[model samples]
Target: MRPNIVVIQADQMAAQALGAYGDPAARTPHIDALAADAAVYDRAYCNTPLCAPSRASMMTGRMPSDIGCYDNGDDFAASTPTFAHHLRAAGYHTALVGRMHFIGPDQHHGFEQRLTTDVYPADMDMVPDWRRELDDRLQWYHDADAVYTAGASQATVQQDFDDEVSFRTLRHLNDRVRANQAAGERIPFLMVTSFIHPHDPYEPPQEHWDRFEDVHIPDPAHPEVPDPAQDPHSHRLRAMSGFDQRETTDEEVRRARRSYYAAVSYIDDQIGRIRERLETLGLAEDTVIIVTSDHGDMLGEKGLWFKMSPYEESSRVPMIIRGPEHLVPQGRYENPVSLLDLMPTLLELAGTDPEVASTGSPEEEIAPARRGLSLLESARRERSGRSGPEDRDVTIEYLAEGTLRPQLTLVRGQYKLVVCPGDPDQLFDLVADPSELRSVADAPEHAEVTASMRAQLEAQYDLRGLEAEILTSQARRRLVAEALQRGTVRHWDHEPDPEQRYVRGDFWGALQHGQIRIPQGGAEGAA
Candidate 1:
């Protein structure tokens, strides 16, 4: 039987913020435990740092620009064939729960069902306008308020939405198990439970907040860089988010970090609950659980508090895949991987004969230039004491808010090249200088490596041409967004089917079969 797949994602969670990824400040026991027996990717990154584009890349295994997902407000066209569609085609039931933040119509995007609505808007309201002046702040841009007002909260919109996500996720898991049991057979499932916690507002519940009350929360390694000394992209993000105009004290930074850590812990607890449910339902041995995030939150690194930057704190994400030992290897991989890889990884995991993988022309679905290798194969090679592929190059893009031109990153071997159109190219040897405090782009000794990587990056993308395309997309979306606001709105948010959820009259029989905590304890009508 094929293994059941569950991908639990946390929004804007940095690899540096998790204990599994070597963050001592993180209180994520469940995630760490999962990492202990899973394939932990030490160098996993999102193809894009922003939320919508990053997820779009993950779903389609294509670069954000390739699919026209330029920013938060861009629509993920229903025409796109996602991992869900591929898996479903391979005889798996797929569902989405919680925040996907899919903009525009067609919220499903090949998902057979959605148990909860998205936390953010599903319209083009949050689109970024590249036509505007670089310094002019948009209505939906990030600000320093999330940092200055960070703390524990009794109740918040994020908390409420995440709570609903957890509830519906558990219910869906149970429903699947019960349905399979009733049919006297197994059906593979691909469910994505995405949470919006730890993203912003920097407010976690008091219970999780108190866990770090006495613990030491360190400050940013690199303090605020003067405007003249900051990198072009970082400087753009700072000015775009009002980071230059604001004054966040040390205490505020600590509170924000503490709250962010608390939110991570909260997400960790949710993971624990999902695992426990799987075990109780006798699905643990046949289920593959993937823990990761769309992108990383900078927190207070270099005085940047959010994503939309190419720094490690904002781009690197934790990716852990846990399943039976026979199916998954137990080891950490230093090879760089990105969200774009998940599509092929998931398709390979769906079964021995997934339609997309067996087609012999996967490029028909996933373009060759944007295609990613299967990490599962890489793990198998690692377990056999064989060297994995040598020519591994992971690319990341930041084409969303907080920039004048596109920021493209090329991670080849140990060196990373950050290139913008006019700004000087910035390069860092990740192995030697993990903190990326300095640049080796102009160093004569490493000139060969920098030049080669820069050539490869430039070859892969036409930055100026891409920028013009992005500008055109932004203008078109802004016009649509404005026109929609003036008329009677037809919201595209997903509304859970009442007939398919809970103990509704139409769903009573199915709900009862799944609701029975004790097997054959009593009849359905018996109190």
Candidate 2:
């Protein structure tokens, strides 16, 4: 039987904030335990640092550029074939129980069922205007308020939404187990339980907040990047988020960090709850659990408040896969991988050939060249000592709210090259300078490496062409968003059926009301 797949995702969770990823202060014992017995990816990154684009790339196994997912409001076409679609086609029951930030009309994408409506709007309302000046921050963009008001809260919209997410997800797992047992069958399932925590507003429940009461929450390693030395992108992002307009104190920073940590712990507890349910239901050993996030938050790194930058704090995310020991051997892999690889990895785990599953309607067709490397194969290569830095290279793009032109990054070997049109190229040797405080692109000795990386970047992406396409997409989306708001409006937000949300009677009446069977020698059973 195919292994049941469960993906627990946290929104805007940075790898640096996780205990499994080497943060000693994090109180995520559950996630730490899972990492202890899983394949921990040390250099995992998101294809795009923004929420919507990153998730779109994850779902489709294609770069955001390939799918025209430039910003949050960009529409994810109904024709797109996601990993859930592939698994569903392979006879797996797929469900999304939480926030995916899916924009456009088709909220389910490919999941057979969406147990709850998304927390964020499923429309083009949050679209960014690239034609506007960077200093003119969009009202929808991040601001200094989230950081200034960071603290323990009695409750928040985010907390309420995540609570419902956890509740519905656990209930779904229970129902799945019960239903399968009643039918005397073991149908495989894929459940993506995502949470909109650790993203912003920096306010978690008071209980989670108290988790870091006495703990010393360390400040950002490199907090105050001098204005003159700051990279153009970072500077622009800071300005775009209105961080430059206000002065944030050390107390605010610490409080925000503490609350963010608490939020992560809250997510960890939800993960624990799910794992506990799987164990109680006798599905632990038969399930594959993958924990990750759509993108990482800057969390005041280098004075940046949020995402939309190429910095590690905003780009790198945690990728931990825990499953049957025999199937997924415990190990740590430093090879670079991105969210794009997740689609192929899940398909391979479902016993489906990615190449074959990738074939579908012309609108759903995934170009083989655009597919990501199978992480299972990557693990095998690493275990056999056949994996090298050259085995995989990750590229990230950010054409979202912050910048005038598209910013792209190439992560190859120990070097990271950042390039943008009309701006000076910056390259950092991550091995030598992990903080990326300095650029070596102009260094005399590393000229060859710089040239090779630039050539690779050029060969892979037509930066000029991509910029044009992004501009056009931005203009069209803005026009549509404006037009849709006029007169009678039809919103694309998903309104989950209230009647079918809980236990209810079907056409047969009262579902399976009191269908109990008493065994002669055993306890009572459900008929």
Candidate 3:
């Protein structure tokens, strides 16, 4: 019989924020305990930093750009292959308890069922008739309320909203066990329990926040950020809504960090509850429990509030796997890995046939163009002392509006290069400067290193068949218009009123028709 799979994923969680990862202030005893039995991957990274794209990539085991899910509002194509589909084909009972962020028609994918949760549908960007009646000012206020109210501080809100997601998941597990007993057959389950805490408005329950309030928080090593003139991305960040140019004092930074830690702890507690239930049901030993996150939060690193950059803080995440002792050894893996590798690894563990794995391929016999290898195989090869195949260097590309091209890519070895279309390139030696405080791109002594990394990046772009041209204003208008027409709009602040708000499609039409012109070039494209 195959082992059951349980994936407990947190949103916007950074590995370093956990005590297991060496943060003295973190209250992640549950995850820490689980890590004791699991193989802890120390260098796992998200393919993209934003939620939609990152989730899409992990679901399909494909890069965001490769699949065209380049930003938060972009929808995953319905025909895209996903792990859930493959697992269903292999005869496992599949289900998602929360937070798939599918943004398309096939919300369930191949999952036999969705227990129940608030899923931001694919049409969320479009303006509904009820919302269209409201005026713009009223709509903006409504949106603000919706977001601020949903931010991470209130215990009532957290338990009422996210905790239910956990409860439903646990109930599903219990039902499965009961059904198996009744049928006199052993069955495996693939369940994903996703939570939306630790991601935003920086709020945590009062008690959790108090636990870390006294803990000392370290200010960024280089608080003196680069001049905005030189770093346009930094400048644009300051200009964004909710981001102010005022100096971030040590006290405020510490306070924010404390809240973030509290949020993580809260999520950790929920995970602990789920694990306890699993063990009580006698399925712990036979189950493969994978804990990870879609991406990492910056927490004010580099004067940035959220993800989208190629910095370590924004790109790196945590991946822990615990199950049958023989499958995953307990230790940390220093080698780099990508979340895109999870699908193939899961398929391998589930004993999925090669034909099921090839479902999404144009030629069923040919394997998909996967850039990742199975983590289980990699671990096995390493344990045998045989020199495994050379690790493929990973790369990330960001193509936000106003940028000349999707020009940021990080080669896994030790060098990172940031290309700004129509501007000088920035290069950093991550081995020496992990914080990326200095750019050695122009240093005469490091010319050879810079040249080598640039060549690798260019070669990767060529191999991927990427077009490096910046989007023309007209083109941008057309794409935005298309998104608006196809997407639904939900106000975060006020009640839904169609008369007061512009529908996504109508908004896009206005922009395309020259009614609105968004400012570009400065910090507009910063992550």
Candidate 4:
């Protein structure tokens, strides 16, 4: 029997904010506990540092560039197959329970069922205009509101949506267990129980807020903020988000940090509940669990509060995997990995050959076109107390709402290279200077290292070509958005199963029987 797969995806969660990732200020006990038993990737990242692009990359096991998912409004082209497509072809019951941020009409890539609609606008709302005036902030840009009014709230739209996500997912698990028992069969399932939290609005439950008031939250590494000339991309992002226009106090920053911490804790608690339910059903050992985030938030790092930047805080994310002990390994793997690796890894765990059925291909055309390597064998080696694989270069990209150009990154063991078309190249020796205080690109001593990294970046991406393509795509999307908003709009948001059936309401009080027609099994409503 194949192991059941459960992926707990959190939104806008940074590695630096997690207790498992060495932030003492965090109260993520459930995440830490999962980290203890799993093989953790210390230097994991998102292929593209945004919600829709990263998720589309994750589902397809291909880079965002390969699929042309450069921004949130970009469609996950219909022909594009996802992980669910591969798993379902192999007879697994696949389902999505929460936010995947899929744009366009075909919401379910291959999942047989979707429990709820996406929380954010699923249309062209995320598209950016390349022609907009410089320094002109969008109406929806991240502002000082979250930081100034940061505090505990009993409930938020985010909390309410996630509550339904959890309740429905747990209910699905229970129903599946009972059905399988009745049929005396072992039907495998793949469930993605995703959550949207720790993202923004910097509000969590009051209980979680009180849990972190006394705890010390460290100031950002570059708390003084960088000069516009020194770090052009950071400066551009700050301006784009309207952060440069307002002055936020230290107290506000602290409160914002506290609220973010509490939000993470809230996510931890939800994950714990899901895990416990699986264990209660005796499905824990039979399931392979993977936890990750779409992308990381800056959270005021370098005076930036959101993603869409190449900085570590905005790009690096957490990737933790746990499964049957005998079937898998444990301990941290230092070799760099990203969400791109998840699709192949999931296929491998389900007793399928990743090389055979690449996530984006149909079963008959089982060719290996994956850009990421599976870590199953290496993770097993680590569990048996053997040395892991050598450090390798991991690539990250950013081309979204923030700036006029694209930012591509290449991260090796200790070196991080940022390749932006307009700005000067940046090279950081993370071992010597973790905060990236100064660039070593101009240093004579590390000239060879810089050359090699730049060559690697050039080989991996055509920066000039991508920039042109991104600009063209943006213009077309903007025109389409304008035309669609003229009169009646056709939205792509998923409409979940409706509530409040008419027959169930006040039938006894009215004493009037209104004849209602029923839809037949194979046809429309019968009169």
Put down candidate 3 lDDT per residue, 267-333, tens digits, no spaces.
9988898887777666777889999998887777776655666777878888999988776676777
lDDT on C-alpha atoms for all candidate structures: 0.84, 0.85, 0.66, 0.81
Report clash pairs, candidate 2: none
TM-score of each: 0.94, 0.94, 0.80, 0.90
Model 2 misplaced stretches (Cα beyond 4 Å): 226-230, 356-370, 500-527
TM-score between model 2 and native: 0.94
How far off is residue 319 in model 1, in Å?
A: 0.4
For residues 1-527, write the lDDT of model 4, one tens digit per residue.
68999999999999989989999889999999999998888888888889999999899888787788888888888678788988998888898999999987789988988989999877877787667864776676666687788889988999899889989888878666755754568789999988998888888989889998689988666666776766788877777766778878888988888899898999999999998878766778788888999889887777888688777888899999998776557778776677878887888888777764444444443212226657665465554656443345678888787767888888877888888887888999888988887899989999999999888778777788989999999888888877988899889899887644245768863232332223456222221
**Residue 226's C-alpha lDDT in candidate 4?**
73
Off by over 4 Å in 1: 226-230, 352-369, 382-390, 500-512, 515-527
lDDT of 4: 0.81
Clashing residue pair totals per candidate (backbone < 3 A): 0, 0, 37, 0
Residue 180 of candidate 1: its Cα lDDT?
Answer: 79
Residues 219-337 of candidate 2: C-alpha lDDT, one tens digit per residue: 99889763444377777777887787887999999999999999999999999999887776667888999999988988887888778878889899999999887678679998888
**Candidate 2 lDDT score at position 185:** 84
Best by lDDT: 2
TM-score of candidate 1 versus the correct structure, residues matched by position: 0.94
